[model samples]
Target: MKTLKLILIFCLLFLFTLSFAQTKGSFKVIVHKSNSNSSLNKVEISKLFLKKTTRWKGSKQKVEPVDLVDTSPVRENFSTEIHNKKVGAIKAYWQKLIFSGRRVPPPEKKTDIDVLKYVHENTGAIGYVSNSANLKNYDVKILKVE
Candidate 1:
């Protein structure tokens, strides 16, 4: 009986550890060095993500926003935490915009490393990644969400 109880305890502990491991951390929106000091509010950031605003003010260069697709956990977190919308709702919103020919979805990268590299090189780019990512070599600044 004691041996059986010990095995049961081990199984429960293993399940608990697995559950904890599944939880992920939040990511922060960041901008390329050229857009670091833009003073963008949450509304503006939302607009950029929604493709409502396209151009940078000082220059004619178009501002590019990058995002992960519907399946990404980071995308899900950003939709829920930052945008206050479910993933499905966000997809519908983008679908409407695309159907109207007003905007196209931002280019997507498969990983945070790809996002970091793309944003770092592009002057008018913005993207998000896990806050714990190593960003020392990149000249990017995290945007403060209002």
Candidate 2:
């Protein structure tokens, strides 16, 4: 009986560890070098993602934000934790905006390296990528979400 109990406990602990492990990849929010210093609240960041706001009023430059591919863990995290919406809900919201011709989705990159490169090169760009990826060479700034 004692041996059986020990095995059960081990199984439960293993399952718990797997469930709470840091996601396979890291994620981070990056901004263009020009806007590196600009402080943005969660609302402003969400507005940008939803395409509700397009231009940076202060710089008079167009904003270019990128999103992770649909259903990706990073994307899911950003949508739910940062944008405060579920995946399906955010998708529906974007569809409506696209249909109205009010906004277009941001460019999607295959990997964090690509996102880092794109944001670093574009003056008005912003993107998210895994946190594990090294960002030493990029000129972009990483933003902290509240």
Each candidate's lDDT (Cα)? 0.80, 0.79
How well is each residue in 1-146 modelled by candidate 2, as lDDT tens digits?
99999999999999888866666544778888678345677888888777678877588677888887776778877787678898789888878878998876787777788888888998888788876778888998887765
Q: What TM-score fits each model?
A: 0.75, 0.78
lDDT of 1 by residue, 24-98 (tens): 747778888777355667777877777778887677577888987667788888778767898899789878878
TM-score between candidate 1 and the true structure: 0.75
Clashes of 2: 3
Candidate 1 stretches greater than 4 Å from native? 1-23, 36-38, 57-60
